[model samples]
Target: MWEKTMPINEVRELRGKTNIFLGVGAIEKIFDIAKEIKEKGIDKVAIVTGKSSYVKCGAWHYIEKALKENHIEFVLYNKVTPNPLSTQVDGATKMARELGAKAVIGIGGGSPIDTAKSVAIMTLYPEYTTADLYEYNFIPTKSLPVIAINTTHGTGTEADRFAVVSVLEDGKEYKPAIAYDFSYPMYSIDDPKLMVSLPKSQTAYTSIDAINHVVEACTTAVTTPYAVMLAKETVRLMAKYLPNALENGEDLEARYYLTYASTIAGICFDNGMLHLTHALEHPLSAIKPDLAHGLGLAMLLPAVVRNIYSARPEVLADVLSPIVPELKGTKEEAEKAANGVREWLEKVGVKETLTDLGFKEEHIEKLVELVFTTPSLDLLLGCSPIPPTKELVEKVYRESL
Candidate 1:
């Protein structure tokens, strides 16, 4: 383990019959949820999803299939999009109200889970929009119990209180959402067996997204030693195992560690928040949609770190340097630490320049404008030692190209 400060992780500390149920494999993982549902004594179940991945991949269908087998009554609401629209969540909440769905199950990756968390909030509160909680909304109303079955483990949606959704508000894209301590899933299933068949591209994307989680958390200005320690372990696991999982889909150990790493990063960031890479990536995702969160981080981090190093170089380098031994020497040699991260990314196999990704040279100015104006920029911009100036951001993009 890389030594650092211990974590001051936030606590909700629910008591009683193990509020969370965890399963690593076995088809029974989905089957056992009905008992939990029965124990929660819920009426109808509203499943919020629609990416075609769950039904086809056996994750989404497992609950329904098991529900029928066990003679449990339920409903399915599958109208979710990639980023998830607030209107769609409202529609799902309406359906749940009509059906009287007493509980919710989120099956699939981050999007469906976000849909489920947001729907729970809307159904319970009935007053707030899915757009309201983008920045720690901390909605007070308690939500219907959620059982999140993560067929994939990139986002740590099960472990988090945040539900992220994007919508076009007033003809312009306004990414909005909320989070609260009460919003976390009552149960988060982490089963690596279900991950056996995950495709290479998705494995890469999700695992890289996990890497972004750890790296961004550790770099923040207000990070605690507790945050740094957990983030350090997470990055070490992601750096070693994410690539293995991406390269060899059936690598159970790799998948397990990466998945665990993903969850750990969410816990780490919840206490300390995140830094500029996430701040930069959000605008790109809103505008491009083509670039998902992880790939966007992959493209921007090398440049982001290189720039930040000139300012807060030592702390940042120490945080990451343990994982990348290539740069380890004396503190005086820490100047080369940023290079280690770039080399490690290449070794993990991030290819293509930003230009190769179809990021238009013409769009850089527009993206810069979006970055400056967005609320997320405010959330994350100050985390950087040298807060990004318009000219500096543009220069980073140019260097990236």
Candidate 2:
């Protein structure tokens, strides 16, 4: 038996419009959520999930039981894959509309939850395509209720108002993120017990993704003191607990703090917004389609940090000190700080270059072009502390290679 290392034994209902329930046994809240929705006259809901995690993480059993025991009807759409495509959302939306699903339950990590968010919105607008929504062709005013059951410790889609989907246009794929007030889940659950079965690569990559969230959030042009404080704590928790979780997947204490880190990182970005790293990573995954979002972010992190370090050297140094202990808050130490971060990522087994991932030197210009042209990516670039010029974007990609 693992000894508890933190005060995570009791489930706490976090205060927000989202109604976030967090702790070890928080999965049980699905029963109460089912009853509440039933009382609202919502007899049916649509469940959007990936192929295996919903069942592997042991969340589906409880969710199914809750819906059945409460006499709430639901249809399961489990075809959502990683780097979710707009077409998948359309399919799920079609099924939900046919069933008259009044709410959507997203069970898994970011992909399914994000897909669920898109389905919730598109179900309301039967005539619009996801491309229309993501490209700002139509401004989304509202969505059906969303209940998120997160099975991964990264991509806090459960807490944020953002949803990312890749829309294929012509022959190319454009992955753009959309954030709307109504996209926030009406209810969300983060239970550490549900995350104990995550694979090792996912364990490392997802936490790194969480770390990247804070790094960009704290260093962005609109960064606030509140975001910076949360960024520091997020980095500290990931640096300390991630290794323990990787070593023992069943370490609930490690899972608890990592889950907390991911949650706050999501809140941090929702408030401070993001900068070059996420802006740049989107195009990478959009181009490859098979690349994991977090892995792409990890590959570009060092290069992006090297470019933006001079913009807020003191804050960057302080926020990254947990992983890069020798970093000093000075513009002259930019290369040293970036190298230290790269080394830390390697120590945690995320050693991969753009070349290793099949990107060539010839691909640099295309990535640079996509950063400026992709929907919402230019907006993210505007948040960077440094001027996101074409040459600077090109240089970041070259350095990563």
Candidate 3:
């Protein structure tokens, strides 16, 4: 097998796509930002967030204090849930519109931020419902400016133009929807101070989710030279710091590295696109909305890695070489890489199977059906290095169970 290395030209040519403000006290700076927006004729902004984490972490109070101190007018829609529902996005959009919000501010993890992305655009296109936001149904043409505050170290929703929302299509079936094109946050505040209060479980799960993002991106055939190099570093950082964060949630340095890793991996996967793991994980979380997105991905990634390694060991070796230096650039490195991932997942408390996450055997058929029928399937199969057949996807799901 050929050894892979980053080219100097690719490193020189790579550019930062998103504007990020990171460090302690970054949320306090939002006051000036709000004033800047108001000066631009955007009188009021809609703050979209989840119910608990921000409030529990003090980020919510910090944001409200900033807006109030700056005399910035805003409305709050804090009902966003995990695996945000289309109905929730619709309702939030309507609320933003009725409140005359000129922009959207998203706080919390990926779901609310993603909902804010949808709500910001939906506020602009009142004619387009969540249905039209579906990949096959709509092409987003316009969006309001969005500012993202990431309280969790996962999803990198703040760093990309893409957002994922779940919709109940055909009245009963749960499916994931994605929208892109200038829907990214105008700027992001990635303050590790905000993540200091994050629970150990969230730190573990979200960090693993970041790891999945890089692994999928680096292994895919369409991965760009710049993204591959970035993902390698992201994976290395995750391997080094995830356990540290989990062991001590207040380890600010570890938290910063994990948060930074999420941003790097998010950008990498945003460009390279994700494959079977994300493809299968979506239906599980979409069906069971209460399930955590990272947990679902965690349950599936090891199994997916094993499948990918079987078919394309070289790809696996390329991605895992940074984490498990024992890869040594050989086909045999695939099993070593896969084993390293499984062992790490266990160490990080991601040892759950689908059953452990409340999924049952009966759900497998429905999930397979959704995979084949949903719009996500096209993107999934297209990016997959191996030709993904129904039997293959189902087999992986069963094995994961």
Candidate 4:
């Protein structure tokens, strides 16, 4: 086997002292983390969160009450969206600064945590607009400490430096809002019960999002031995546990495995990152902000896999074969795994097509233009093994229609 060279080493490995708040019922952990922040003499703290599964599952109130009981002067910014905007983040940073919050707590799912990261960065540099932060490496030298609690098992945005804010630059919106800060959470709370109250539809969407993270990261770039190992583990756990976690929502063990798999996928992609599926999905989510990201992901992913099918088919096919059994071992078998993904997504009750979600062909041109013209498009789309052009992007959009 020829040695695989690292495509990019620009991803910084962020290390920070983290006070991990956790448990199946870790209300105590919340209290402990809050008290620690207070005793450390942190001046002010702000909590940025929103109504989501985490709110329904009840971590939001628990954390909120804990902070209030501790008498920590803080502000609350909860007007965040599923696909959060740069404007909202700027608003949050202003809230934090006006309140004089020194530390920030992120509750709910990826959106709020993602919101918190942007707010954390913006607090230190109040002079800059959110647009100034969208450039690849324009972040300030330091930021306020942020703690996150992941109440969902997907899109592990809480544990890393990458926060992709979809903001319009010159009349176009793209993702990857900030990458330089390595906005590593000052703490992470992974509570399995947090996964329990999720409705089945949401459970499926979030789980597949995690699964795709593993598949895309494993196949996106040249895999290092370590990255591949975590990717494989993520795949194994997801394959074995996703359906069970969905079917048996009350099982803490299944919840734990799925949550760990989601985080493993996060760590996997944190090292390897994502490709066209995510890049394309960003616009779909932005255009239809009502769509859960995982739902948009499910809608666009199979098309992305099929689009990339013929390019580097052997390696991607093999990496994916086990998840869809028919693709394992044989060349034809390996090559067919991409289609199997689409089939499995439908079989598992993920939305089968764009029409299922009420989107029509009329939406294609706008989505395609967004995909091409969005800020940071050149960077994210460039990650595909077979480079995609504006035309190819339209083809994927039309096919999904």
Candidate 5:
């Protein structure tokens, strides 16, 4: 008898050291943010973003106007790409430091935001490379301020304390995620209006990423009731609104709910942490740097669900039933639940399997090896319901293919 609550129509300012401005017209808050940082004596900031989303999504205009009005100086680093690289982070850090930039503003999705976090930390220790930080070669305790301007409804890097970057070592790329207390942004903006311009493919991919976040968060070993509650709402919102947003790209109402779903999903993983899906997806994107993070996660999710269901059947069944109504909270329904998830992904236009995305049986072994060898990924596997064995890793990758 529980009915879903309607999305709020008005903009609201959420307060914290990491203040968030969300909803329609929330990007305008950049004016206030710019002024606040300027008053703190930070006159120069480095803007780290991809080549175009910041401008294409209509956030760059407001951000640029705000900085100009506040007389704040900013240097642009627009070379960040999907599956962001440590070399790019290092390049940006070098630019920011040389320009005397005191803070970093990350625009677009997780890639740029994560790059900004890495840049913020690396700016302080000019001696350390991003690989050093991601590999735990040094424990960093401080970073320049980071402001996240989220233009996509996925990769809640805006609200979490984690950043993922790929580093090249021994002629192979190793993508590792780093978490530090200072990785949290000092300010974030999540304006649904900015998301209205997202393309159909990205819309589908990003929402799938949000769903995967909640799915793994709810089933991780550290999951709590609070995380479970947020996870269920995230799934429900994505189920109801993602289709509407896909059908009509300009539907602000749908964008609002999906954006909220992505944000809370970020919080869920921030609190509950993540497991196999994220652990596995990182290696996929790391190996194929062109693969979209959300798409990779989508490809891996069904098999991961089947593998983890027995560990927390009742919880997973409840959280996932919004998308998979056939889930009956019984151990016997694991396969059914996972199949239902795959069906839902297909419904959302994410029909590519691992092999369809160019992975082969020969690649499975390397994928499994990366799962164990990638820094911090093994730690994520430790939080899984089952043992983190090479056999199990190969089985999941093979099944996904």
Candidate 6:
């Protein structure tokens, strides 16, 4: 493991540029923010979101009312789905361009927010085809402004510069890739009221996903003290408030804390990055587009933690201490951490294994091949505490199964 203090210059290089508005009724202020955007010479805007969640939850109604009140001319691109495809991004960008939208407002969880980020930048480079956009070399110098509304407590995409989108390549296979800088949202809103109608299953999964972010980022080889602090605070909040939020979706205080933790964890992982678990899980979701990102994280996190334990016990102990009480008193740090995470997942009602989620034993070899071939493989290697081997990754997959 690369254990050394982060240089002051590196710490200073961290970038979290979103102007955040967090409170009980922050959604009500969207009208004023829209008015401000209009005042800034943006005559038209685009609202990117999932097909039904926002509408069913009434969050979309609120956003529409606010935009109408501000006379903010905008187009609606509500075709986004879970594990958002680059096709959806390109489609949204095409709509925004045709409507001449000067900005984009993402109104849901990470999928929509990330889609909006990609759309915002694509608007600036309309000459590039969808295939051209995925080339990474075609980086945009600027993007239309973006406003992120947190309708879910997971995916903290609202507060970070990075976006994850699935791109189809080499015929039919879809790969997950990272985009940054130009994709960051210009503003973020965290209104607890907006999350009151989120389903319990989603609530549990998203909370676990945030916890996964904190654990993976804080224990990685690239973490800094600042990153560790953010991760620690996130874990503390997850341990104390996640169950409350899961048990009673109407609990505004619990919802607020979880939302806060998700945002902080976003900033942490955006700087510290994530490891093998994310790399492994990304392909699962790309292959099974209907699977929620959080569900995959919950199923795989404990196994990934265990795989790295022998090489980084002390770090794992510190990482798991807040959430796993047994780890606070054990010399067996890695074992305790892995067991604790598995226990918590079951306690929170996320007991599904890879098989339960439709990963058959026959699919193991192909999954392993995809992981090794992934474009994000370098990131996975850099983030793992112990450098991963192909055989080790295959074992993790079988264990997850």
The Cα error of candidate 3 at residue 24, in Å, is 2.2
* Cα RMSD for candidates in order: 5.1, 1.8, 4.9, 6.4, 1.6, 6.0
Model 1 weakest lDDT span, ten residues long: 6-15
Q: Each model's TM-score? A: 0.84, 0.98, 0.92, 0.87, 0.97, 0.92
Residue 358 error, candidate 5, Å = 1.0
Off by over 4 Å in 6: 1-16, 135-137, 328-332
- lDDT to native, each model: 0.68, 0.91, 0.78, 0.72, 0.90, 0.79
Off by over 4 Å in 5: 1-9
Model 3: residues >4 Å from true position, as ranges?
1-15, 310-312, 322-325
User: Total backbone clashes of model 6?
Assistant: 0
Give a tens-digit lDDT track for model 1, residues 101-220.
887888777888888987776787665665554434444668887877776767877777767676666655555435677778877766665676888767776776776676667667
Those runs of model 4 whose alpha carbons end farther than 4 Å from true positions after fitting are: 1-23, 52-55, 68-70, 135-138, 168-172, 310-318, 329-335
lDDT of 4 by residue, 55-93 (tens): 687786777777788888878787887778888888888
What tens-digit string does per-residue lDDT give for candidate 3 at 176-269?
Answer: 6574768878778888778988888888878878888877887776878777887878877888888888888888777777877898888888
- Pairs of residues clashing in candidate 2: none
Q: Residue by residue across 53-112, what tens digits does model 2's lDDT show?
A: 899889999999999998988899999988999889988998999999999999999999
Could you give candidate 5's per-residue lDDT for residues 1-401 as a string of tens digits?
23235445577876644677888889988999999999999999999999988898899999999999999999999999999999999999999999899999999999999999999999999888888998889999999999999999998889989999998766765888888888899999999999988999999999999999999888888888988999999999999999999999999988988988898899888888899999888889888999999999999999998988888899989999888996779888889989999999999999999999999999987888888888899778987878878888898999999
Write the candidate numbers in order of decreasing lDDT: 2, 5, 6, 3, 4, 1
Task: Give the winner by lDDT: 1 or 5.
Answer: 5
